[model samples]
Target: MRILHKQQHLPPLDGPRLEPHPFRAAGMPPDKSNGAPLVPVNRREHGLEARRTDMAADQRGEGAAVNTEHKDGDRQPPHGAHDAFDFRQLGKEDFEQFEALLRYAFQVSSSEMARIGWSDREMKLSKKPIFEASHVMGWFYKGRLASQVVIYPMEVNVQGEICKMGGITGVATYPEYTGRGLIHSLLAKSLEYMRDQQQIISYLCPYSIPLYRKHGWEIVSDKMTFAIKDTQLPARHPVEGQIERVDIESEDLHKVYKYFALQEHGALIRGALEWEEYWRWDSDDVMAAVYYSVDRKPLGYVIYYIENEVFSIKEMVYLNQEAKYGIWNYISAHFSMITKVEGANYTGEAMAFQLEDSEIDETIQPYGMARIVDVQRFMEFYPFQFSDPRLTLDFEVKDPIAPWNNGIFHVSWQDGEAVCEQVATCHSGHRIALDIQTLTTMLMGYKRPTYLYNNDRIDMDYHLLKTLEALIPPDKPYFSDYF
Candidate 1:
């Protein structure tokens, strides 16, 4: 069989597992498929429209930080570099201009809004939730909002350690304000704010990989889309758990995920604010089936829908192998109803190995990007396998956006805990030098030090390489949600 891999533009998470409907308050219209009935499955909004749907994300809650960080010689003169620009956090009063710029940047047309059953009144109501939940910052010239960034306070599980993660979204600048370093300052400010909030790490769905990389972000997760015929479905695996269809916003749904997120490495902690981000463009008719053990404990759940003879799996997560089998059994039971099954696997691994027939179609592509917002703080809490006596590792990180990360970060163990302190000079000790991009991916467990070393992305000796290999846990991050 011949295989072809391709890239497409997409769509926007963090929190306690919020039971509230995701983005229901963000003027999410009713079941009006906006006169476009064939709903896009899982970030289908980007696939439905033009490529690089990240611009559309600019309309929502992704964007951040301020001016202290000077990227690696990337400081460009603003329209009036010497002129004073008001860089501040946005409030409810600034909602109108904020909405205007977002709609303009994302190209959300009047007709599109009307088709989706949205009104000026409904649009106005959404401001409350957005303002309360997001740290929307902007640069205003002549009292007009031109460039902006919004960061959501969120958390993530990295090898079982919960780290506050800043979700950067909705970054945009008017053409007239281009190359003035408005974004540079705004992003710097956002990063500063994140640091204040103790958000050591940051995540964003990239509109351009190289563009974000210039700022220190790197690919941390991937989306693997698979298509399987009814004949290829695995024969139902016998299980003790029972599956039952429930409301789309079922508590069991969120609770199961809450348990899953808390334990799973690299999972997003979804609170109320994050829930809103999850269902931003989803239909209300969506359904969920939860898998409960014989004793009635939720172990897993599957959110899905059926349309046009296709069983689309919006999301399927299980806490254990049994739950995985039980969920698959539910999907196989629909064999007579669906001609094919389609879903995305975000584990950066092939699903064929687990299936009865391994000939199904699968596609893997880069999904999300992240970076160490505050390198010192991130390492301070990072769960590195401690070495004998005391574990110590130094990182000569080069951050292009946040200047604070560009230097030698001396990380060592103290009292059985990891401690990170920046040093002016690299001493004669075990040292591994790399940029912020490589460091972020390595620490996140996406790529190993040896892999990056072989790829020539790391500067390290053979002994230090082996030390890093053992210190870092081995596993790619699992992130299926798009924010």
Candidate 2:
């Protein structure tokens, strides 16, 4: 790919157009003194190091000028620099450091050191000269990468509209530097960069909830966890099929997954890159197996293996009733060797009901938290009826962490359609105010809007409260994969 310095000319790629959203802490300078006035950094202009320097300075003192040199005259570490920290952009040359930082940050094994996995190669190439060095950012201290964050350009189908968005991941901070504000600086700069790029929205799988909310994000989606007990495995089979496991090198597994993706509502269309990443995990440690039909035909598949005699289902995809039954029976028959099978997703039916005795544990873990970085964009993407009568309602989105989301929105509907507009007050009707975070939670169907209102995170009039509940569709938000 050709690199361009001026933003005016560049090859087009699939990504969101970002608008700058500068962050000024309370009582912070109104002046644009945050380093070089926020230059857009991307493949066009790779000035990430300089940009970080300026932003860190601003965050440090709000008005302090950035010092381009290491502490003291020499580049030696600060005397108390063990705790004293500075931020730097991790160059491609720092892969070893990046890998080390990741290993320390996440406490995973050295499986990442393998030579030929998709994620492994991505990490390797990310540090190579040929790779396009855009979309990822990291923060370092004392010549060591302490905390890191990465944003990849992507798109998501929100409501019914496909919107350009960014998926943030690899958020890991070194053990010793957990509470030292490293993540805050990294995220502030990342958000600023995302805004400048005109990314209408951003998504991330959070390590914690309240932290990201403070920086201007709202939860937009969630995943439900389900458990199937061996006792629930029913005897009667609905469809005639045989269950078999194919060799890892066989070509039939792809066919099974391809068929599965076509039928599932929330399944991701995994390309070669995604497939490689999935299969790259250590199979011995985590059973990575696939399912096939009785007539030597591939119908359904699963990517999982037993751990500690507890059969963990990392993922299971079946296109039709036969495949689902075949796969479930195949796994359940192994009850002698396994204790249970567990996973999470948004499914129309409970896992236990399909089993023999229907005696299973239904444990739902909310996975993949999302935030609406842009409220107007989020509202615009909302699908509403266009053929009915018009009705107007008020919405008070109280987002303290990201004030831009904290405001009143007038929603009007007619002919089975809806639209939103900003409003200042509500005099003749019901009123409500919910923190943007709570609203995010409500949006994902994790909790009821009225429940949030009762908790005081949301305030609204009775009628408006009912309307808000009605406005939000009752569907469990589902994200099957992590970015």
Candidate 3:
């Protein structure tokens, strides 16, 4: 894998200093001379404090200057040297090396990369935009890139409110750096950055669930994939909309997608970049069709492709029942050319009931995991439906990874709104007790509080649990984007 470094004015390593041994406690700064702890700084706050600290150390003859090493080869530091590597944001000039590393880590062959329009030359010159420089964090050891992580700025529909979310992807570490805990340090730094940016939640498609679970991420949604023979497809039903074949790049597709995302819980509010990624098809056989009404207003769309008589539906989105039925009728019209159909649904239910045969093969798989980056901030914006009168809830939340959330929280609701605040004192009895993971899933509507209580995942009074359940609306979480 290639490694490139060209940007000037790299940020100072004001984050927690690394110890000689691997796997040191994250976010724990080195002890000061007076045996006092140093205050941690967010990304923005780091600049002033780092400069002041550097100047003070230089005056003391300590010579604590920012390392500015840039070379193409590995250069080992002297024994016992603490500042041996540089960590900074990578830019477009570094895409060559970045793509090479991604290819190796993701096992993308040259042909496969070319098939996805990621050829080295195309990626370097297209300028359509691959990723933002600030979003890519690189850990350079001895002038060679050894580890990296990408955080995609995104937003999700939490209940009916739009909440800022950070989607993490492209996390990779070279084999030689596997045991150094570089990933942990990077993640800690990323979390602090997210908190500063007001991003209260994070989501990731895990390579290993257990690995990410240790970092406070838990499963939040599931996807069901179905395979049905042509004979099993439901007969076409009359609807107000008429299906019309359209180009994949039609603007009407996004119109339908936006309407669907706003109405669906846990769906991502995609931006232009994410939309491009979602519509990027590798094969030329992909086709699109829109369900339109008599007035020519689009309400739904479907993207699919056929291969060897097997029809594959890449995506299906609709805004109403008529649009949904119209799209299904469009798909059924292809029964003459295709023998089977395959598609995915995130509602956790098989589409077999809608088919002529209810025995169609279907598989349910966990989709993605999410974590509450800042519990207090998330709860402040959470939409809680308050019933007549008023309700108050006391929560004793336990978060081992994020200490800011490990405390007693008092939440009061009135007039369809809630006010949450962290309390100094604890309340005995009559309080819901749950860890961060359980709290995350419960608030996301993945699991009801009563279910968690019955399953021994939480401790709470039955009546109080029922009240908590009533405050949270029932929602079937659905997330379509991969990253």
Highest TM-score: give the candidate number. 1
User: Which of 1 and 3 is ahead in lDDT?
Assistant: 1
Please give the distance, in angstroms, between residue 125's alpha carbon in candidate 2 and its true position after superposition: 5.8
Give one digit per residue, the lDDT tens place, for model 1 in 1-483.
101111111110232222332322221222222123322334211111231244334323222222212222223563567286687788878988877776666666667657556676665565457666889998888888878888977888887677778888777776666656677677778888988888888998866675576566899998889999999999878999799999867888888888777766788988876776676655655689999888787878998889898988888888777788899999999989999999878877799997868999999899888888888777767766653434566788766667788889887666756667899887737667777788999999888877887676777554455567667777678886666
- Relative to the true structure, candidate 2 reaches a TM of 0.65
Clashes of each: 27, 32, 0
The model with the greatest lDDT is 1
Candidate 1, lDDT over the whole model: 0.72
Candidate 2's residue-wise lDDT over 1-483, tens digit each? 111122123344232111211321122222233123222333131122443354344334321001110111111122454356656566667667766665555554446454334465565553342113345566566677766776766554443234555667666665555545555556666766766665556777666554555554555555556666656555645556666565654566766655444333233445554454455444455543454445556666776667676777776766556676677667767889866677754543356655556666776554566666556545645643232233455666654334456678766554444556677786425455555566556764556766765555655443344445555655444456665
Q: At residue 78, give the lDDT of candidate 2.
A: 29
* lDDT digits (tens) for residues 199-299 of candidate 3: 88888877666556545677889888889889888888898768988887788877777767766778898777777666553466788999888777788
Q: Candidate 3: misplaced stretches above 4 Å?
A: 1-83, 114-118, 123-128, 387-390, 414-416
**Cand. 1 TM to true fold:** 0.82
Give me the displacement of residue 418 in model 3, in angstroms: 1.6
Task: Report lDDT (Cα) of residue 73, candidate 1.
Answer: 28
Tell me how candidate 3 scores on lDDT: 0.68
Q: Report the lDDT of model 2 for residue 131.
A: 19
Q: Which stretches of candidate 2 lie over 4 Å from their true place?
A: 1-91, 111-134, 140-146, 157-161, 174-180, 196-201, 216-231, 240-269, 276-300, 306-311, 332-350, 385-389, 413-418, 423-430
